[model samples]
Target: MEITIEDLPGHTKASLSGRFDTTGAIAIELPFNTLANERRALVIDLSNVTFMSSYGIRVLLRGGKIAMSKGAKLVIFCPDTAVSKVLTRAGTSDLIPVYPTLSAATAAVS
Candidate 1:
């Protein structure tokens, strides 16, 4: 699994791929923690992500909480139905905004 971070003007995007859960926490957290240092707004891209668990959803929600605590907007994009289901079931979607497209997320953050 890989989590690649890209810096945007007012936010950051973490491109997530492969299985994202307890097993991939380190990889995911590295980029997320990077975003926490400088940027307040964050957008996690899930276009390439194939698998997710409750722990993966926790990562997203936790990141969201951190971003929001810094007076930021935390948006998640391109989450497939399977991944979305996990967050939905965990009620994480209620806290984090899920965008169907990167354009929408980028627009929101920008």
Candidate 2:
């Protein structure tokens, strides 16, 4: 997976590309957690993510917990239908908010 981070007005945006399977989760776990730990507001862009697995859900849940513990916010935006279904079915969409747009995601975290 490819992860690109950008600093926005009131939040940090992390754009993820490639499959969010086990390998992808491992590839991004550390850095993603680091951002969750450090940033007060983190908005993840899932527009480019092609697939997701249980491992990906784990990473997101962990990140969300880490951010919450730090009194921070972490949200995802622009997940395509496939990815969105995975998240929804896994019940992660309830724990971590998912927005339809970057602006909505950023505004939520802000």
Candidate 3:
């Protein structure tokens, strides 16, 4: 997996590409958590993520909780169908909002 972070006007965007399985989740966990720790508003771009596993969901849930505890928010955008289903099934989508477009995600965070 590859993680790219960009600073937007009112929030930070982190784009994840490749599979979001166990290995991928491990690879990104630290940086994702770091962003949650530091950023007030975080937008996660998952359009390029092709696959997601339970571990990936765990990572996202952890990040969301961390952000919330810090009085921050984390949202996901552009998730493909497979990833979207995984998130929904895992109930992660209920805790963290998922948007169909980047604009919508950024707006929610903003």
Q: Please, what is the whole-model Cα lDDT of each candidate in the order they appear? A: 0.78, 0.92, 0.93
Task: Provide the clash count, candidate 1.
Answer: 0
- Evaluation by lDDT, superior candidate among 2 and 3: 3
Q: Give stretches of model 1 more than 4 Å off.
A: none
Give TM per candidate: 0.87, 0.96, 0.96
Error of 2 at 67 (Å): 0.2
lDDT of 2 by residue, 26-72 (tens): 99999999999999999999999999999999999999999999999
From the highest lDDT down, the ranking of the candidates is 3, 2, 1
List clashing residue pairs in candidate 2.
none
Model 3 alpha-carbon miss at residue 3, Å: 0.5
Comparing 1 and 2 on TM-score, the stronger one: 2
Candidate 3 similarity to native, TM-score: 0.96
Worst 10 residues of 3 by lDDT: 78-87
For each candidate in turn, give its C-alpha RMSD to the true structure in angstroms.
1.7, 0.9, 0.9
